[model samples]
Target: MDESNSRSHTEEIPEFVGPYKIEGPLGVGGMGRVYSARHKVLNIPVAIKVFFRDVNEKPASAKRFIQEARLAASIEHINLVRVMECGNDQDDHPYYVMEKMSSSILLEMKKNGNYSEREAIDIGESVARGMSVAHHHSIIHRDLKPDNIMVSVDGLYKVGDLGLAKLQDIENTSPGLTMTKTGLGTPHFMSPEQALDAAHADARADIFSLGASLYFMVTGKKPFEDEGVQAIINENYEKGGPDPGGLNSDLSAGFCQLVKKCMAYKPEERYQTMENVHQELIDLRHRFHDSVKPIHFDTCFDLAGTKKEEIERLMEQHAKAASDKPKKEPVNKLYIVIIVALLILLLFLLKYIAL
Candidate 1:
């Protein structure tokens, strides 16, 4: 939680923020509070992210809150959370309207321990496409993690908090002022360069985080883990991490290699752009599909049998059909002779007519 700088408060939550009637608090984080609300006029449900009163007092935090809205709004991609409106409330607290998502990727991870390789790849591709849009506009989502990746109501993974990483390291300098620090973003998913020098980190840093995220999704473990934050950072920045294939033996070599490339210690070695990562994931998916043979049911069976029993029977039938089918057979000599005789007779009759 980044609420270390937030001041304690006991005031009752507001019933409304402008035209939207506040339903309740959905989530509260270091950035601020996300409230579930509905527009009184349109009766449409929306999530409103509002800066804490203490956070709003700081100009630096306020600037970041506004920047997050602008940065997210600039990229009109389906895989990104849609920013509807942003401004200050009557009390001057910064707030932005966004489409209400069902939950965060973290929640999904908890509900279903580590997705299958294909599910992880599919989600990773969707997120990469979204980040590709941000990278194109020169905006790096310095903080890319499962928590920041939201699941839309429609089940699409949407990346949120695009520009808030810049403010994540803000320290409360005084009563109403905050100062940015050299370090920002989650330590678990930071690229080597990003962990070393966040201010200078580029799009490659996002690729590393995306890889780390996918690594977590498929393996159900972070790429690097330690009791101390510094220890984890050192491991990621220095030794990198273990081969994902070693942990998840079910993963193909190509998929494992692709993920390892993303977490490369050297930014230059990593995928140069989010587009490249996206394309690679797409290609990997294609390869995975091609490698697996589709099961074709030659005959429909009754539902009386168990699924496993039915599958076993189908396999047996397919194998018998494959083995019993003739590989080759000699052509009938009698048919060939009949064709030759007909041709000879037709030629003889034509010659006789000519004579």
Candidate 2:
């Protein structure tokens, strides 16, 4: 079950975290509870994630969690969730303010039944751009799933829970972590490396997870067979993959090929980089957009306004450039005219003498 809707923090007493007023609980998790908070004075809404458990009690876990939060905060991109602030109050339990996503795509799709292939491709393109933007910022989402892909009301797509799985990466970071050296992840979504040995993981590991999500969108089914968490993870050790082509004829050959590359047993065999996968998705979007005629707004009026502004800016830039230059040589126009008249008379005198 999804956490966003099921969890609400409305009834909690002293409805505030830091400066933001906690209007309600957004959701709950094993580690913490998320709240819908509004800034006291600014009244800006933010998602406040309050750690319900004592992370300090689990030192490495705490560090990993903090690292994830810090790393996420450092990255500034449209698709990625933005971190606002982090601090603790009198209780000493910590919470951080972050960008609130409108809703999860997984929840929405499940609610609406499977989407048409065209819609799926469009969403895929948006998600790819978001991921590409993150990769450009040197931050891998680490955890890319349908639940993490959130869509805003006006068609803005955001990737949430950036590096949320980083908490599991902290071997030195958490002594009292989750009682395991290997990290934990939901079944069917875990990359083989993450499922077997986390140290073998890297950015492309996210590509694998993305492929799994893409497979789900197209087939309306998870990539791997549903099984116990341990059982599915054990299969990761064995390195098994689902047969994408067998299930859906609607799945394009290129799409399945990319998915196959993504779910490759060897990480090297997967997409070389996140950008590579993003490019493929982008190319696919272009083709799809081309096939389905797009609405291109004629900017005659808008373009005219834009051009006017641009010319004004250029004129300002020209003036600034002119002002920045040192004073030029003042060539007297009258003096030049006088010199020309003298030179003309001299030429006439020379011509008369030659005649």
Candidate 3:
């Protein structure tokens, strides 16, 4: 569920949904309200998303809601939220139970405005891993924003909220759920193709969204900041957002390049699969740990005059020079000295015999 949807309301909360006792409201989405709940028998904490009866009455909404639960529950990945069960209440309102997350990436961003480049990469990688699994299962997560990514108490990032997910295999059969040129997904994080036609968006679309999310994580700003939703969508479709490195000079060139590739205007230009994105993020994490250092505020002020390109070039040269340096061979000075002494002793003995 989206944390941004948390709002005070006058509606009475349900005491129980199926076998789980509803504790409190977690957040609300377009189709339903998420509540923190516990299993009556096991006392295990869980999150239950109860579909609004009015919305559930609609055939399209009902199918989409149930599909979301089924799709999420089918995939069993550590980085993806696990769905325990789904059923209808006495009032015929549909609800699905999932493992309750401690928090979300959205909450983390709210508490901490921006994340370090490393932190952003870690989050991106986790989400990519989850998306990779979904894509493998022919599921396209149209909405891959921070609000949909949850973080557990153990610091594990889990991808959730597949309410807008597109199933490639069943899309043709379910034309009602097929979003056409209307453009689904968050404007700021959606890909150009998705903005044009969400129904046609493939795995690369999710890659673009993930990239945009990473951009937001590191820069503390939306990829495309516009006055309105349509303008934001236009910016994403016509012109890509500004460079992440420019927004946050602390970001490394490699990391910025990764984001740029992910946010490519054309789907073909973006990473072909979530696996590719995951691998690149893994590589970036390794590079970050091996050589990259987080730029501090003091360091930024110290090198205020230097351009990012110059710093990157210098670092590249330094790394290259270090790698290209030749190793020195060992020398035996004692052996050389011994040989010289023997030669001198032989010469002196010959001279004395001659005398």
Candidate 4:
């Protein structure tokens, strides 16, 4: 057998991609292989995804892949996965370099059935923030499943896998455009319109997928799910989802309403923007926390700005800029309130102690 044909899909990675040393295989899929690599001087860990070394691969496919990488590398949002660099190997196998994040995905977490209502809502909103950034750049994360969402060490999410996502303003929208014929994305998370007419899908498709993800987080199962992809598509075109409040008997009606709104059959009926979806999540989380009444907001903000790149970059690196800005004194309003309340209790205690 030919060595090329004999190589397993999960074969060991080469020593280097250009200059970066390929440490090992990270993951693999039908499209290509991802490897853990290291920048020689920078020592930065990056995940490099590469296509198969096939010279006869479709021109459009390769072109679209490269374009997506380039576009993704330029978009600088904290919530979205950052593409540090991109290039093609000697065999014309294109690859991208990206910061390697902690690889915990929501898909794996959903299996445990431990998602509280507030956590589900927060996940939905965090993902929406990333989606909004992509939408702003005229890009749609056509594949918005939990596997594509990674939570970093600092507990912030960075949306990954822009490989299948389409840029709306690109020339590929014109006639004779070649779309991914089969399995462009995960069937479980696709919107009805996307399942039916993928090309016609826009940002709204992402909103529906986010709803599906949230549904899984909330209910621990897919609504309108099926054993096969075709069946799933058919079910999606019809009505969708488990009866929210009825299933869990723990979800609030307001949160259920929001989920249903996100899963609207028509794009027009769903969330108009990701920002709106995010804001709803924010409000819902706050409401849930309010009922609990013992939130440690101080601890939450203790290591504040630890995960924010822009803040540290401008504030620390550029001393002049930080000096120019008026520094405001830190105020602990919550602690002050607590102290005042404690003082009132102490006064009552004094009278009781005296008696």
| Candidate that scores best on lDDT | 3
For model 3, residues 22-53, the per-residue Cα lDDT tens digits are 99988888778899999899999999998875
lDDT of 2 by residue, 78-125 (tens): 776778888875577677788777788788877887665566666666
Candidates 2 and 4 compared: the better one by TM-score is 4
Between candidates 3 and 4, which one is better according to TM-score? 3
TM-score each candidate: 0.81, 0.70, 0.79, 0.75
Kindly list the per-residue Cα lDDT of model 1 for residues 145-219, writing each as its tens digit.
999899998889889876544322233322322222354678878776776667667888889999989888888
Off by over 4 Å in 4: 1-12, 107-113, 171-183, 294-355
Tens-digit lDDT string for candidate 4 (1-355): 5443444353656788866889988776445677889997788888888865653287766666676687688688888888988877766578888888776456457546547787777677778888898899898888887778877767887788887787775545544343534446778888777777677688988988888777777677766648666788667557654356656878988788888888887788988889889898888887887665232344345445566655445444445544576988899899999999999999999999999
Per-model root-mean-square deviation over C-alphas: 6.5, 12.4, 8.3, 14.7
lDDT of 2 at 207: 80
Q: Give the poorly placed runs of model 2, Cα more than 4 Å off.
A: 1-14, 54-56, 136-138, 163-180, 233-245, 290-355
Provide the lowest-lDDT 10-residue window in model 1. 172-181
The Cα local distance difference test for each model comes to 0.79, 0.68, 0.84, 0.74
